[model samples]
Target: MLFLNELLDELQSGDYFLLYVLVSAIAISVIFAIIGTIVSMNKLVFIAGGVSHASFGGVGIGFLLAYHFGWKNFIDYSGPIYSALVFAMFVATVIYFLTRHQKRYSDAVIGAMWALGMAIGVICIERVPGLKISIESYLFGSILYVNSLDTIILCILAVILSILFFVFYKTILSMSYDEEFASIRGIPVNLLYFITLQFISIAIVLSINFIGIILVIALLTMAPYIMERFLHSMKQIVMGAIVLNLIFCICGLAIAYQFDMNTGPCIVVFAAIIFFISISAQKVLKKA
Candidate 1:
């Protein structure tokens, strides 16, 4: 309680930057909650990780192109975000089509793509001459360094995702539960699935700065998974996951601040602990 008071006091006493960081953290959590629900419901949680790693290739490409050709517009911080979006969408689309037939080999394919993406990123970064870039932020995240523009972009994305969710709730629900039934009913299963992948890609790309690429998948899938253990309805799962994500993000942020630690790992570590606890509790209940 005292720590909470002190943190609130610090934020209120002109540390508006920290306030922005907190807002960004919360917004990313909400975005993750929404995307996480969709990913888990669709059973594409692994794909989320694949898409995220694939985005690193895009970041490398963006950096290379920006430095070599002097694309000033693409040299900004958001440049990698856009680049990753394109790469992620492409990867997601490819994976979607490839896995359509060989369901058994989907994991193998995704694992290959994951490794390929990171390898490409490393090669690109190494091959580029006179290009100075730190992969630390992309790998481990540095949410505290987020600026106002980043916050605004995150806010816009959150709103867009919410609106999309509201508009396509039924379509998404149907597609998630049973693709065959959705296709039978002419729900445009392929189209909707593709769109969902794109959204997941976008979510992963945007969240890279907030949670880093390596840990972003955990944020995207863990909360929803946790909620699923308790909730059966999609709506309930979404709402529950959002609340859980919010609590986790805030707690992680507060702890990071107090300890002067890295926020991304802290958040992931906290979430991992909660996930283990939830699983243990479930086991105990099942035994009873």
Candidate 2:
């Protein structure tokens, strides 16, 4: 009763923004988790990793251009962030199309792009002076400071992506399982693959502000992989990943609030714990 009263008081006092932030974080997590699962199921985790890393270059380029032009009025800092997302997606699509023929060397291509992106970001950041924000936050994530605008954008993207995923569920699953078969069956394999790549890019960018680029891949891939070990269907896997994501988001945010820890790393730590627990449970069940 006392706890309820305090909660009510917090809600009445606008402390509910914390709850909003928590929900938004979970939603963002869910989006990445779904994208990660999609890519992983299609045997494209490395490609996704490459795209995520390459996005740093996009960020650097965006920042460099905006900073040099003194384009604060025209391009908000976050605008470059979106532009970087577009650039990264474009690069991913090109890489995907180029490597579609030389399937064996896909990883090598991804690795080269990843390194180049990082180098570009480094040079861009070094050239800039008196930039108040830490680029590291974008690389790793700083979830606790998420504003309402970020939350809104995340929610909107998640909804749109979810709808698209649902409508094209069969095409996506078909492409994942056997692209050649999908193509033979007239599934528009190339178009579907391109769409998936673009969506993955957007998902990665959306996640950057929450988990940082370094750990974002883990949050995206790990939750779905762990869930897939137990869940049979793709639907179950996605749902389980979303639930697990929500659990981590809430627990991480609460702990961060209570202890004054950084939000992004804290959420990843919580997710790691959950992964361990799930693994242990699976082992115990197998033994029993």
Candidate 3:
């Protein structure tokens, strides 16, 4: 383990941002691991994708308000972030209602919403007079943009989410695999679903900066699913996912930095490699 003084020395060095990267990765891993487990358990991976892209609408709205309407303070003062949260929650709610009884059509509906949000974001961004950042930053993760503020926000969200997971541990576990049974046990199944999906929305919005919307689903589902093949309990699955995500993010960032590559896609490629390897392991272990 890194000693405190040594850690402090490293933080003060020229590569201080490395600390930011490490913290951001760990915090995001914690949030994604827990959320991913719930998402995979409930089989809402596609909906999660919809929610992730839906956040782009909020991001565009945020930039428009800040640059077009003089809400610059509002944008960074949790404006765009909160707007994305609201937009994502709205999309998640819509998906829930639309698919509640129309299971056969959920995919089509979610795809429509997904495209709609990205379109809105693109159009809104086009109106910003002097936008400095590229849309790809939001689309494919921007390593150069990782800073102290983003790291702090991620840390705060991670703590809040961890607390929530603890408080609703059993309820979530029960609902994950069997919502009907959870409802039979008097757990407000619908309410929990709405609330959890909302949480997932905010997570995606915040995580956009680190991993981008394009790869959010993989971080939020692939690791959890891979762990499921070996782990039997939710806690173990989440823990294993945290470790797996850390590996993907850290290794991806290192490789990206060394090769001048896009951070988001690099991270996802590592995940894809691991996912395939896990498939092989699953087959081999099954025969064992």
Candidate 4:
């Protein structure tokens, strides 16, 4: 309690940048919670991973084109963010079509794609002469570097995701449990799958700044998975996960601020500890 009070006091006295960071974190956490719940229940966590890393290819493409065309306003124009969105959506669609038939080699194909994206990004980045892109930020995350633009993007996404969930909650829940049954009931299984993947891609791209590509999967999966142990209904799981995500983000931000550490790792570490405890408690209950 004392710690939280101190943190709040500091934020009250801090600059506008700190306030921006807090807002961004909350918005991103909300999006992640809902999207993560969908990804978890639909059993598409692996696809989320593919989309997250595949966004780097888009980043690389943005830089390659901007540098080659002498576009000096890449930073001001959000060139990289657009490229990532497009690239992530494309990859998500491709993965969906390729793996829809449940081929033995589907996982292999996604793995290849995962590697190809990183490889392409590295090559493109290396080809850009005098380019000084922050590869570390993309891979490891840099929440402190999130600007107003990023926050706006995340806020819009959160609104859109919330509406989608509310409008199609029944269909989405049915699909998550049984695609075959959903199709039998005339639900457009393929379309819902595609839309889900699209949302997953967007969430992953936006999350790069807060959790980075490497750790974004963990952030998206672990919280909901923890909530799942105590909740049977999908709605309950999502609501619980959102609360847990906010807690992790706030606590992590406070710790990072106090120690001058990276916010992404701090958040993930806090989540990891909770996940461990949840599993341990479940085991103990089972034994009893």
Candidate 2 error regions (>4 Å): 1-11, 15-20, 73-77
Tens digits of per-residue lDDT for model 4 on 99-177? 9887677788788778888888888888888765577777877765687788888889988888888899999899989
Higher-lDDT candidate among 3 and 4? 3
Q: What is the lDDT of residue 144 in candidate 1?
A: 50
lDDT tens readout by residue for model 1, 1-288: 433676588777866666677778778877888899999988898898998998899888888888788887776567877888898898998898998678899998898888888888887777677654467888878765588888888889888988888798898898888899999998888888778888889888987877888999898989999999988988889888888888888888777767877778888999999999999999999999
- TM-score-superior candidate, 2 or 4: 4
The number of the candidate with the highest TM-score is 4
Q: Model 3, range 188-213, lDDT digits (tens) per residue?
A: 99888888888888789888877887
Model 2 residue 103 lDDT score: 84
| Per-model TM-score versus the true fold | 0.91, 0.91, 0.90, 0.93
- Which candidate leads in lDDT? 3
Q: List the residue pairs that clash in candidate 2.
A: 139-212, 139-213, 140-211, 140-212, 141-212
* Candidate 2, 57-109: lDDT as tens digits: 88888778878888775344466577678878987887878787888888788
RMSD of 1: 2.3
| RMSD of model 4 against the true structure | 2.2
- Model 1 lowest lDDT segment of ten: 1-10
Residue pairs with colliding backbones in model 4 are none
After the best TM-score superposition of candidate 2, give how far the Cα of residue 47 lies from its true spot, in angstroms: 1.2
